[model samples]
Each structure stands twice: as structure tokens, then as C-alpha cells.
Target: MHYCPYCGSLVIEEEKYCMKCGKELPSDFDERVTSSKSKWKWWKYPIIISLVIALFITVLFVRTQQQENDAQELYQQAEEMALIGDYQTSKEYIEQALDHKNNFPTAKAVLDFLKIAIESKNTINDIDALAKNQNYEEALDKLTAIENNISGFKGDLINKLNTTVSDYRNNILYQQAEHKLTNDLSKDELKELLWEVEEITDEKAEVIKEAIQEKIVAHTSNHATELLKENQFNQAMLVVEDGLIYAEESEQLQSLKTTVEKEKIAFETAQEERIEQALTIYEQEDEINRNQAVEVLNVNASVSTNEITVTGEIKSVATVPINSILVSYQLKNNDTQILENDVYVFPETLYPDEKGKFEFTHFNKEIKNNDLTAEVTKITWFID
Candidate 1:
């Protein structure tokens, strides 16, 4: 294909204008890419069996028997050329048949499919070259562009194009799967790649899909196992949940889920016991007051180009010593529209009538607006 000299957009030699940039193509650009692909290779030849064409001819000849005309002869000649893998000659014959009989519907349909057949044959050649060089992205792009328009093709032509599309798509996916698996992409990225492979609906997709399934299940289970050891049960569960979406019946992933659930229940039970014991001690010391005893005070916010810094003072009026305080806040715009809700750990303990300060910086280089103010929503504390 020729490229637009002005914009470098790809354009076929037959195109008068660039599809991407709409620029007039230079005449010299057509000289390089207009070489005729006149014959299909022996292995790729014979897309439609001769028996089917014979049957089609028998039916068409009966319909045109009364005319005994030039159009009928030209149409038969086109089918003969097509059967021998001469797509360009066959398309020319079909076009001649149409010129002889402008009102012939059967000839019109044959011309449409003939054009698609020629295009499909040429496309497969280009895809072969691109695939040989491992240029899968461009190959896939070319296939997609052809597919969007070939839906109107009829008869053996559609079957030929479909086979071409399916074979190349699976080939590309299989190679891509092997190449990408050697890289260091995250599980989600790998999963996305395999999900495309899983769509082939043919045995070609299954081979690589099975390998990807094992990798994802094992990788996710190992990650969740590590998180469980660190007492991060919730995050571990999320990881296992993601893995199960790709391999729902995986024993490793299911076992990981069971282990995470048991761990979470045990941890929450222990946490409740600790809180109960601490509350009892505070009550015995006549220092327990259970009615929302933590307050956020002197909250201030500052905005910069890359950051929104929120500093706040917190006082504990609870009956017991509180540590690991959690603060939830919202950032709102000037119109009182909330933009984000987040939490910050106060990082210190506070006893009754004691105060502590916290500073949280949120916005990043990717953040578009840092002109938001902070709104404290909820505060909670726990004993050591």
C-alpha cells in the first residue's frame, strides 16, 4: 500500500484520496503498490469446490436459457476463472457480464461476492507478510477493517473470507499469548489478553487458554496466600475473587477463598473480643462514655498545583485510651459538590481530653483540580 505523502496515512494505490487525512495523493505513490496479485498459491488456491460451482452453473443456466445471450456466456466464463484461482480475471469477467446485462440481479450478486473474494485473497497475502515479521497489531487492524465491510458478501465468497479471518485471528492470538506470557505484566493485564483468545470458539483457542488459566490461578492463589499471612484477609479475598472470574472451577482459587473467609472470621472475632475487654476495663475505671466521644477540630485545607493537603485536629473524649484512629473525609468543590471520599489514619493514640493532629496529602501529578476543600465525615478509634 502507498502512504499519503502529506500525512503518512496508509492508502491503497487505487485510492485517490487518503482515508485518514483526506489529502490528494501524489501520482508517484500509485506506481509502487499497483502490482497485480494475479494468482493464488497452490496451497491457498481452490477456495470453492468445482462441484458447487457446477451446481450453481446448472441453476443459473436454466434461469437464463431463454435469453441464450452474451451475459450468460460471460457469467459462465467468470465462474471458470474463479474455480482456477484467477480472482482478478474472474472479477473482470463478472464486470463484463454486468455491462452486457445491466438488469441481471444474479450477475450483480456474483459481481459483489467476486469483489469480496479478490479483496479477501489480497488481504490474506498482506496479513501473511505482516505476521511473518511479527507485526500482529497491523495485521489485526487490516482484518478488522475488511470485516466491517464484508458482511454483505454472499455464497462461497463469505465462507472463504470467514475461514481466512478465523485462521489468521487465532494464529495471531496464539503467538501473542506466548510472547506476552514471557513479560512482566500484572494478572489483570494477562487475564485481558487471554480473554480475547478464549473467544475463538474453536480448538485453536483452547490450547493457549488452558495454559493461561493455570498461570492466573496459581499466581493469584500465591498472592492471596502471602496477603493472608500478613493478616490482609480482605485484600486477599479480592485477589482470589478476580482469579475465579478467569478460572471459576479452579481448585487452588476455591481453596484460597475458603482459607480467606475462615481467616477473616477469626480475625474479626478476635478484634471484637479485644474491644469488649478494653471497654470493660474503662467502665471499671469510671472512664467509659459510649456516645460518639471523638470530635474533629481545627480542620484546615490547603491546595497546590499537584496536591490538596488537609490538616486537622482530633480530640478523644472516650472513656478509654484510643489508638489507630481512622478519619474519613470528603473533598468538595466551591458549589458543594463532593469530588472524592477518602480515609486517613491519625497515627497516634489519644486519651480522654487529649488531642492529636493529622495531615493528609492527596492529589497527584495526574490530578486536574486541587482547589477542593476538605469535609470531615466520620472518625473512629480502637484500643491497642
Candidate 2:
């Protein structure tokens, strides 16, 4: 008998190689195989069984370690996403990790945290969207809810959200106030809107309020200017008075008021000059013929309760018949100021040396002077 040295398989002595192991045998292989088999016989089967069991345990341990590693990887991914505020995606990864390893404690804990974080994050996102759409009232309500519900939230994120909501609220108010200012609104209505703007605490609110004030001043000044151009001085002053109530420090309104006052003075002066001219033209004797025309005499004034009557007589001093006669007279107060002045015409032919009586009566309530004077200012006659 022989044995192959590589495998210790028994073979016949004539064979060069062992058939079972396909290995060549050495001379004296049987002696060596006999010695080696006796040395291994007591422990071979037990060692083989122990090695198979160790291999099986090693494979199971490796598979378990791999599963744990895979779950840890998923958890790490979830953690990374959570740090950057992507809680929804982080939640998905956390759920996948728990599915991969049902007993993963870290994954289960993170999933619970992620659920709360996702809810809070979604609420904040919804608030931001509402603010972007200029729905500040609704956004504020949502923000208040989030604040009440989520305690110990991220401070920096909450502060940022607060700033966004505040800015959106201010912008909406500013836009509304700006729209009202641009329109043709009354002073009271504009002031009411301006009061709303003044109550806002935003940094830009002051600037917007100033702009609206300027618009108000400009509108008032322009409106007053139009009235001034139309010679409506009293109405223009009223406009300035109303505008000053709103914009007391407005230079435009003040300046416009000054201009209107000057215009009023100039207008009154022109009116007084015109009245003086009319009275002075009648006082001149060059416009009347005192010899050939009828002469006015015996002028007398009588005042009653409701009327004042001025009676006079006119006689043709020339030896010719006058076709038409006119008598211009002026009524003066005790201060010699002309109160009422008019001309009266007789539509009759007066024969030579004929006398005609004339009377002028006026309502006493219409005369605002304390005394009255009747005098012939001018007379006209027809020459044959």
C-alpha cells in the first residue's frame, strides 16, 4: 500500500499516483501514510466539524454586519438631509432604513424626530408661500399656530421667518397706501389713509408716508392754482385753508396762499379804480351841454321804510325842441363816498322851454349807506 503525499489518500504499491486524490506517491509513502493517519485519526472528524461550524458563523456575522452597515448608511443619509432642512426627503430615507433593519434603534428614533421636523418644516413653508402671495393675515395666523405648537424650534430659522412675514405685511400696506395717494382723493380720505400709513412700524413706512404727503401737498396746490387762474380767489383760499389742515408745513400750499392773497388784492384794487373812473367821467362838465340842453333843478331826496325817492325837474334852457333827454345822477353817503350811481333817460320830445319832472326811486334795503345825495351828473339834448 501507498499513499499520495499531497492528500494522504491510500493507493496500491504498484500505482504511481493515488486514484482518489490524483497525486503521485513517494517511495516509502505507505510508511509515512501509516504514521500520519495514526497521528490525525483521533482529532480529524471533530476538527472538521468545528471548522464548518466556524465558517457558517463567520458568514452569518458578515451578513448581519453588512445589514447593520447598510442601515447605518441610510440613517447617515437621512441625518445629512435633515441638517439642511430637507426633512421630507430625510423622512423617506429614515423609513427605508427601518425597513432594512427592523430592530434598528437609531433609525427608529430618527424617524420619530423626522416626523415632527417634517410637520414643522411644512408649516413654515406654507407660511412663506402665503406671505409671498401677499396674504399677510392668513400667513400671520399660520405663523402664530406654528409658534404655539412647536416649542424649542430653531431660533435662526424662526427669526428669518418673522422678518419675512413682517416685510410682507409692510409691503402690502405700503402698496395700498401708495395706490390711494396716487388717485384723486379728497383731503379727508387721503388723510385717513395717511394715518394708516403713519401707524406702521416698518423702516420704509416713514419714507412712504412722506411721499404720500408730498402728493397731497402737490394736489392741493395744483387745485388751488386752477381756481386762482379762473379768478375764484375766495374758493382758492378755502382750498388752501383745507390743505393746511392736512399739511401744515407744506411750503407749496403756503406759497400758493400768498399768491392767491396778492391776486385778491390786485383784483379789488382794479374794481375800485373802475368805480372811480365811472364816477369821475360823470363829474366832468365837458360831456354835458349846460346851455342848449335841459337843466336839472330842485333836486330833493326822501327816505321811507322800504324805499328812497329822488325827485327833480328839468327845463329846456334853449329855444329848440329836444328829441331825447338823459340825466346822470350819483347818490353819496355822508362821507361823500358814492354809494349808488346811475343814468336815467326820458324817451319823449320836449318842446322849446318845456319843463319835465323826473323821479328816481330805489329800494332802501338795497342801499347800504347812512345818508344819500342826489345830483345831476350829466344831461343830453337833441339839437334841431
For each candidate, what TM-score against the reference?
0.50, 0.37
How does residue 84 of candidate 2 score in lDDT?
A: 72
Q: Write the per-residue lDDT of candidate 1 for residues 75-154, one digit (tens) a residue.
A: 89987787666778988988887776778888778777778778877887998898888788898888887787677665
| 122-189 per-residue lDDT for model 2 (tens digits) | 77677667756767567667656655544444444345444644565566667667666667777677
Instruction: Tell me how far candidate 1 lies from the true structure as C-alpha RMSD in angstroms.
Output: 39.2
Query: Which candidate leads in TM-score?
Result: 1
Q: Output the worst ten-in-a-row residue range by lDDT, candidate 1.
A: 34-43
lDDT of each structure? 0.76, 0.71
Model 1, which residues run further than 4 Å from truth?
A: 1-77, 80-86, 92-105, 269-384
303 in model 1: Cα distance from truth in Å? 73
